[model samples]
Structure formats: C-alpha cells, structure tokens
Target: MKIKQGILFLITKSEVGGAQKYVREQIAICSKEFEVYLSTNEPGWLTEHVAGEIAGQLLDKRIESRTSIGYLTRLAKYIKEHGIGLVVTNSANAGMYGRIAAKMAGAASIYVSHGWSSVYNGGKLAFLLNRIERYLARLGDKVICVSAGDYEVARDKVGIAEDKLVLLKNCIFPVNATAAADRPAANGRLKLLSVARFAHPKRMDLLVAAMKGVTDAELYLVGGGKGEEEIRSYVHAQQLDNVHLLGEIKSFNGFGDYDAFVLISESEGLPMSGLEAMSAGMPLILSNVGGCKEIVVNESLLVNNTVEDIQRAIRALQHNYVQYKMPVKSFFDINFNLLVNQDKYLGLYRSLIK
Candidate 1:
C-alpha cells in the first residue's frame, strides 16, 4: 500500500539566493518522504532548476511583494484539489499568501523566515511590509528560523509565541563542492569572494572602499539585485580595478580560486553561502549581523560593517590568516553538518502536521 504524501512549497522570487536555495534543498530533502509541489511566480532560476523534479505550478496574479486576492483563491483551490496536507513558505512574501491560502484549504502552514524584512534599511514599502509581517507570524502553525538571531527577533520583537517559533539553523555539506583551480600557496595578492544580493544593506560599497588601501588584495563580488548599477558606478568612480563584480554566477561553491569569502550585508538569516564557503574549506570575513555571527563564532573575523573597520580587518587578516583558517571550517563541520540538520528538519515536518 502506498502512503499518502502531500506537501506544497511557496516562494516569491525564483532567483538563486540563500532563501531560494534553502527552499530548494528542503524540498529536495522532503521529497524523499512525500510528494512535493512548488508554486512560484514567473520563469526564473528556481523554476528552471526545479523543472520536472516534481509537480510545478505558477502564481500568475500578484502584487510587487504580496499575493493578490485572485492568486490567493487559485492557490487555495490548488491546495484543496491536490489534498496538500502541509503548505510551507520561504521568504516573507511567500509566507503572507501561502499561510492564508493554506488556512482556506484546511492544511497546516509553516513559514521559514530567511530574515525579518524590517531589520534592514529600506524605503517606505519595506517598512510597511515589516510592520505587517509581525501579524502574519501567528498565522503559521510553526515559524522556522534559519538562525538563533532570527528566532529571537521573531519571538521578542515580532511578538511570535515562544512555543510557535523554532530555531532550525541552516547546514552545509562539503562533499558536493565544485572543483576550482586552487590559488597558489605563495599568495602575494589575496583574492576575496563575496556572494550576496546587491541590495542597500549588503554594503558592497564599503568592501570596495576597503580595497582602496589594501594594495595586496582583490575582491570578486558575485550575485545581483536592484543596487548592482550603483555599486558598479562607485567601483568605477573610485577606479578600484581590484574589485570585480562577477554578477550572478550559477555555481554556489565555485570559490576554489579565492583566498577567503566575505559578506558585509546589513542583515542576514544564517547565509547559506557563508556556510557553503566554510564547508568548501574557505575562511570568511563577515559583518557580525544576523546569521553571519551565528555562523562564525570567532570574533576576530567579524567586522563592524564599516569601511574603516573592514579595511583594517582585511589588512590584518592578510597577515594572520593562517591562524584563523582551521577554526572557520571546523565551526561549519561542528554546527552545520548536512545529515545532522536533515534529521532535525525531518523531525519537525513529521511532528508539525500530526
């Protein structure tokens, strides 16, 4: 006899980011136990990547960040017709619509918050969404946070119940890293790689500024977002040729040629790229914000998210990198192992619907 399995996942953007990959990896893991479905808008990286893997559906009617009334009805109808027992949402926008639709369809809802949208610096719309997100926290049967920091913020500031919030930290497995040409051990020029969206709070401009003084270092900024042009203009204006924007690269673990990985985002929820870098045996220089702090425990590698501080950290790290190398990767193994995390998530999935 075949056991029943019905789980649907909802995400807003299909671009390849930590949140998208988080949803992808979870769906991949959960598919082993149940039938999986994905509902996203448009044709994007996520749509192309997950094609034919499971049942695919598209949410056509939508606003800039929130689902529309028509889309919500369609989603609920899809859920009811498919007999979906669980509806899990990743990213803030997805949670908003997915939870409501799940309720209409009589299914359990789970919201995986990458980070609270309100924490970062954004204009008016972001502020409004941040305000509304707190109310939605109570809609989910469980609100899964990717970092302890996010979990705390949701519970303390967002007014989510202590019992409803769960800390399910992100994990990495090094076994699947791509093979990039290793940098020469001599290392006269330190090459740094940062994989993050070019958003306002990402602070790539600070990284470029830090490079101006560090004559012995170069940086490759990967990923894309609305702020890409401004960063490029700043880099060009500063004449910082040492800084290169690789745009959005398809491969996440392709940092084989760099000396270290860096992320200076104003906010995060335990970035997947940072953990992947650690799993790939790369050291990190990160801002001590959100999940980045949770990923790297050692305080030395953490910067104050400023130009002068980052510059000093870069110059200092270039000299004493050998000492900080082992501890970074070791932390990933201890705290973010793949199988260890899989069991934790699997347990949550089983218990939530029951």
Candidate 2:
C-alpha cells in the first residue's frame, strides 16, 4: 500500500499506560506502512519503548483557555507545514486540541478515546467532561473507542454519531510464549500480579486493603506513576510485608513471577496488560468493569470494587487456578492479538487517506 501523506499521532502525554501502549503499538505497525509523526507534552517513557523509528515533537501546553488556543494555533500550523494528511489523537486532553487543530488545518482527524473521561470522573467534573467530549466529538471526523463500553459512552453520553463512532479494541504484537513454572508458588504463597501505573484510577490501595488478612498471599505491584508515593505510604502504614512494591520490573511475565493476575481499575478501554497476562497463561481476578470484564468469560472471576469482594475473588482463583486459565488464554488469542486485527487498523488509515 503506497501512502501519500504522513500520519501525525497527537497525544497529551508520553506517560506509560494503556493509551501509551496503544500509541506505541499503533506507531510500530503504522510506521512500516506510512510515515508516522508524534506530538506530545514531552518525549515520555514510551519514546524508548516503541518497536520502530518515529519522528516526534514536544508540544507542551496547559489545559487553559488562552494557552490552549495558542497551542491549537501552533498545532494547526505544524500540521499544515508538515503536510500531515491524517491526525489521530489519543486520550481526552489531546483529543480536545488535536481535533480542533486538525479541523483548522483541514486534515482528517480521528480521536481515540481510551475510555470516556466522564466515566472515570465524578460530580461537577463529570458534567464538565461530558460537555468537553461532546464538543470535541464534532471536531473529530471519526471517534475510535478502544472498547465496546467506551463506544457506547461515546454515542450515548458524549453524543457522537453512531456512524462516526468506531470500536477498535486494543491489541499488542504477540510475544514468544514463555514456559513458566506450574502453580503460583512452591513456598505456599499465592503470587498475585498487578501491572498498572500507580495512578488514581488504578486503585492500588484497594488491592492492598484486600490483602490485609488473606493468608499466604503476596501482591506484586508493577509500573511507576504519580500515585507511587500514595501507594507506597499506604503499604508502609499498614505494615503490609506480604505486599511487595516491585516498582517497574521488566522481568516478570504475568505468569512466571506470579500465580494469578489482577487489575482492579475504576475504568478502562480494554486494557492490553490484562490481555498480555492472559497470553502468558495467568488466571485473572478482574474488577467487573470495562474491558477486563469482557476478557474474563467466566463470571466467577469478576468482582465488585470492595475489599471483601476482591479478597473473595482472589481466594476463589487461588483454589481453582486451572479452571480459569483456559478461558483467559482463549479470550486473549481470539480478541486481543494484533496479528488478526492489524489489517482493520491499516484499512482505516487507508480509507482516510483515499
């Protein structure tokens, strides 16, 4: 497929998360098929992790009235100057500026909502976010939701047209299958996995609280984030020796260093990590929310956000690990693998440029 115009990928931050993962994978795949340009707040951690080479620019701007407009003008100018034909924005913040700038520059724009901001925020904040998304929806030529639930919110709550909203579930390039030792732990301890940025929605505290009295259970918290201090402080305060703050270790494949995988996020757009863990053959104890719920076919693994429910779910997995492993792998191979879904994304880009 010969491509005429460069694809500009605009995102708010370079932080490590599901949205960042999507950006990395998208660029890795798209760069092979087209010219990929990235614009973000800083050359974040993802700068080092992508699969292929990309041209990136730093466009830092506060989410304010005057400052945002200045950034928008600069972005529009950049798009026109670079001859960028398709502008795709990730996350809500970038969606705001990128969509409007793409409109001003006469470039086709697609806003990829990792998840609705309104779904995660509360009270007055949620109300404001709903209005912001509704406004951004008009500026974007197409709105891509990373999950079906997110797609529903884009149509029902954000008021994006059903025709304009597209559900492009997150996918990752398949990894070589690693042979992990059977059973969670030989020392009689249950190794639990939690891979997420230690951020607000991650709810690491809830995970720790659930671990309070669970016997022979050790929780390994992975990834770094702004919420690191809060999570560390809580773990220290509780004197929870069973919980090990592994920081960000690249070594632990969800199955090898852990017995079971778990993520109790408040909201998500079909998290790629859960899929990654499943590909590694780890049993899951997921929150009954968003993509995780959809990944785990068995309702037995899904639990509410309460500590008791999490504890109950974890205990159930610990007792019946083998029963859940098959379904987890089945879900990942069938839904989240990029090999099967890459053409759909490529065709979307091709259609836009055509």
Candidate 3:
C-alpha cells in the first residue's frame, strides 16, 4: 500500500470565524488523501471539531508574535521531525511565519490569504505590510486567494508574480433543500438578517443606523465581537426596538425565516456567512467590496456600506422580494457549490506535491 503523504494545516486563530471555517472544511476533504496534522495558537471551536479526524498530535505553534524566533524554530522543527511534505498556512500571521518555517524545513508551503486585510483596509501601515507580504510570497510555493478582488490586489498592487498566485473562490457544503425551501409567509414586517463580526470592515453600526429608516423591517444581527458593545449601545440609544441581536451562533441551521440576508461591510473575501445564506435560498444585500459583488443576486443588492445606501437597499429588497430568491439559490448551485470547489482544491494539492 502506498503511504499517504503528510500535510500540516497551520492557522493563527482557533476562534470561530470565516478563516477557521475554511480550515475545518479543508481538513475534512484533505484527510481522505493525506496524513493530516493541525497546529494553531490555542484550542477552541476549530480544534474541537477537528480533534477526532486528525492524527493524534497537536503542535502549539505560538504564533501571536510575528517576530518570535521561537515561533519559527519550533514550527520548522516539527515539520522536519514529522517529514511533512506540504504545509498549508491560513491567515496573515500564520502565512508569514508558516511559509518561512516550511521553507526552512525543506517542505513546500502554500499561503492561503483569507483576505489581504492590510491592503484593503488602507492606511499608513498598509504600505509597509503590503511590502512585507510581497517579500514573503517568495518563500511559499504558491498563494491561494479566496476572492477575485484579493487576487487582483495580490498581483497588481502587491506585485506578487502571477505564477505564484492561485485564484480559488470560497465554498460551502450542500445545505438541506427541503429545509431551505421553506419561506416564511410575508407578515406585516419585512424580516432581514445580517450575520457578521461587529468589527472593522463589518459596519454593524451603519446597519443599526440604517435600521432607523427601515421602519417596516425587523433587522436581526447575529454576531458578537469587539464592536458588539458599541452596536448594542447605539441600538439602545436610538431605541431601535426593531433591531435584534442574536449573538454568536455555532450553527446556522434553522435560520431560514428571513426575506433577505444582509452583510454590510467595507470589505470581504468571499464571506462564508453570505454563502451559507445563499445556500439557504436567501438573497444578499452586501457591500460592493472584495468578492461580495460575485455573490450578490443583482446590482441593486450591492450597497456602498453606508447608512443611507444600506437603508435604500433594504427597502429595494423588500419591494422586489420574489425576484431575488430563486436566483440566489441557482447562483449558489452553479458557482459556489461544494463539489466544484472540492475538485479544485484536491487538484491544486496534487499539483503542488513533488
């Protein structure tokens, strides 16, 4: 019998987010062909879900400090000791340290950028970080971009060679058709859902402000983050009784009663929340940034991440409810389906192997 090649998946955070979800889903598919191993900063939902599937060893790759010599040395040592052939790194910190460590250990590395946050976020720090990313791209065999917007930035702006970059969009597992088929009857109120971390780029604050004008709709915001208190305070101050905060949800199952799924952010890299909502046959009202445009049902659903625009978008969605629903489902099936992405991933992995 042919021995399965060893592959190490390194991600900086163990928290529940889009990047963590991508790592978890990749593990499930890659484990079927490779001897899978995982390393993270600490234990959380990502570690918990992957525990049973991985080979019985975990590496604490102390990844908090990007300049930590110990971080590089320890991770490199592990790769050499285990004879790991391929190292797949997720997130920015992990991408930097993990790629260098993989190179040091003589294993091929692929840096998967969830999003080029620094470049897209834009500020003084962005210039320096973008330079650093361009330099680091040389250490990895290839960089996988989750969105077309990211791909353009990585190549055109960051100046990474086209040969070293791969464009693979985000995807989700097949949702239950029967469950997703159920549409709540149109009551007097228009029910809208926005699932996102209340942080930079994700302007839940604007969504709250937008809610003031969207008097006829009930806005359900389902996420918790550093910006949660701020959002909650604003909601309280405005006395926006129509805005409901559902906190963090482990499973998106049974969240299918909304008229439209909304994510008003400054930027994104193919958000899993949007894809999940699309799978459930819900239309999207997203910011026209990153790859959000790729998943939107129509041009009208893409907003400018402003209070006025988001308010206008919500009203538009309410007016043309039936037109958006079927297209959202059909688009998910054709473009962002699980089976299509699985084939691309497995093929990419095989090609990278010597």
Candidate 3: lDDT of 29? 85
TM-score per model over all chains:
0.91, 0.91, 0.95
Model 1 scores a TM of: 0.91
Worst 10 residues of 1 by lDDT: 178-187
User: Considering only N, C-alpha and C atoms within 3 Å, which residue pairs clash in candidate 3?
Assistant: none
Model 1, 42-113: lDDT tens digits are 778877766766665665537235637888888899998887888889876688888999888888989988
Off by over 4 Å in 3: 1-3, 56-61, 176-184
lDDT of each: 0.78, 0.77, 0.83
Clash counts for all predictions: 0, 0, 0
> lDDT per residue, candidate 2, 52-162, as tens digits?
467555456452233476788788888888778899888767888888888888889998887776756655687777777777777678888888878877777767788
Off by over 4 Å in 2: 55-66, 175-180, 250-255
The RMSD of every model to the true structure, in order and in angstroms, is 2.6, 2.4, 1.8
lDDT of 3 by residue, 21-89 (tens): 888889888887887789888889899999987874455656877788987898899888887888899
lDDT of 2 at 304: 90
Q: In model 2, what is the error at residue 297, expressed in angstroms?
A: 2.9
Q: By lDDT, rank the candidates, best first.
A: 3, 1, 2
